[model samples]
Target: MKKNSINRVIGFVIVGLVLLAAVIETGRSVYTWSQQAAKQPRYTIVIDPGHGGNDPGKIGINDVPEKDVNLAISLELKEILEQNDCRVVMTRQKDEALYQAGDTNKKVADLRARCQMINDSGADAVISIHQNSFTAESSRGAQVFYRASSQEGKKLADILQTQLVSGLDPDNRRVAKANSDYFMLKNTTATMVIVECGFLSNSKEAELLTQASYQRRVAWAVALGVLQYVSGGLS
Candidate 1:
């Protein structure tokens, strides 16, 4: 072969080898990225259906019991959370009451039992769901409450509010705050939030609460909020 032809042949072989090396590197990068994605933490979130059994909670003008509403919302919320790859645990999955109320303290004891379940579930946080009611029919909108002294609770609540407001309502009504009176908020070992999902006393809000479409929206917004917290941090 001519010397010039031999040199050209060598140059082509070198270029081919370089191209092959580039292809291998690109494939390896993609495979490594996918593996890292698969290894990311799959967080678990616990949902508490506030008020059950004899504890009817606040009754609406339409005679819709608070416990029923709490459970319904909670079940929907669980579905949303699970859809987003979060493992969910519910304190009450159905329309049963939580406390027997044998005595004034019996109700407290029952609440403690429920709280212990959330604490023991090994969940990152507990979202205790409930509906609000007041003498004023005009009262409406969702609210989020948290343990005032808990740094983790505050962090989750803050992220939740940012996510909740993004798609649900622009208003900051559902922000987290110190709520010492709630038994669940006070007792749970993990960071806790008690969400009052609108006022049943308000006629318009009460009607909206019972609708399936509205419930789905509420659940989705809640799940997004919770995810933002879980993915973020307690702070």
Candidate 2:
């Protein structure tokens, strides 16, 4: 073979080898990515924003509606959870009740519909958001409640309580409580929690809860708790 021809042949072989290696590497990368995706956690969560329409829950010091606050926080949490790859299902996305307009008993219909939605979702976790009230204005801080019979519920509640206290309300001394009598807790089949984000009766908390920034912060805390629970942090 001529010298120039031999050099050209060698270059061609080298180029072909490089291309082949690139193809193999690309395949390997794609396979690894698919495996990672398969292993990634896909948790389904049900977020229930308590009260709406005519049912303005627990009017606060400045007449801040608990229903509106719940919805706002739930929406923020849903957004964060979706971004983190969690499938979030919300009970009410707007300022409307779940019950039919002409229902004979609106409150009962609303509660039943919310419960049915939560049960049907087959969710890994269910969070019912609300604001608390007390006869005394000094009541504040967040509280988490779970079904008395469900171990999963307690675990979720504990994780959430810790997150809320640590991340949002550092001064919060409240802990998770078990309740078998609550309508949603007793009726819902999945692991469920009712998070009273704050005491709306307290003027300070009512003011904070009304602010969008504070609601966003509360959502972040709830999101962290949910991630920890589903990721087996407490397991």
Candidate 3:
């Protein structure tokens, strides 16, 4: 072959080898992901949508109630988890409170009832979804709170916080926090984390939280975090 032809042929061979390597790497990545997913323990999780019925929780800048936002995200997370072969138990599937009719101090009753459900379900983990509110309207991003005494809960929370910050809220600067004050987290027998999905007090975040696409993104990130925890990916 002529020198020019030989040079062209060598260049083509190098390009082909590079493409082949890329394809092999992609295949390896996919296989690894599938194997990890298959190795994940089948988990039963309790998804608590915080503050329903008379308890509207925080009111957002767009006038959307936090209860509704919480429920929306929880429902989406439930669907995603179920699709991944997880058994999901929802604390409340509707707008109604968990407390029975004519209950005195309905708020306390509602929380206690949720705790009972979490304990009775024998859940592997619990995710209580809520929207945050603050005196400052600039406060934004997702935050996760776990039981101070539960190491597994802290791990889960850390994974969730990482996923939320990296995938959904890239600007999020919050870290996973240990909170002993939340009734559900404090009382649940299972490893538990409370996800404050975003700040409803922030106009920008509140607008995003209300959108269905953003809700789905938040749910997907949470689901991935759960799967990662169960599969020992975080370890």
Candidate with best TM-score? 2
List ranges where model 3 is wrong by over 4 Å: 1-41
Q: Choose the strongest candidate by lDDT.
A: 2
lDDT of 3 at 67: 96
How many angstroms is residue 28 displaced in model 2 relative to the true structure, after the best TM-score fit?
18
Predicted candidate 3 versus true structure: per-residue lDDT over 1-235, tens digit per residue: 9999999999999999999999999999999999998976488889999999999999998999999999999999999999887889999999978888888999999999999999998888889999999999888989999999999999999999999999886778999999888878777779899999999999999999999999999999999999898778755
What number of backbone clashes does candidate 2 have, counting pairs of residues 3 or more apart or in separate chains? 0
Tens-place lDDT per residue, model 1, 1-235, is 9999999999999999999999999999999999988765488788888888777888887888888788888889998888777888887887665655475676787788788788788888788888888898977778777888898888777766666566556764555567787777777778888877778999988888777777777788788778777777442
Ranking by TM-score: 2, 3, 1
The residue pairs found clashing in candidate 1 are: 52-97, 52-98, 53-96, 53-97, 53-98
- Candidate 2: regions farther than 4 A off: 1-41
Q: How high is the lDDT of residue 28 in model 2? A: 100
Q: Quick one: ranking by lDDT, best first?
A: 2, 3, 1
CA lDDT of each candidate? 0.80, 0.93, 0.92
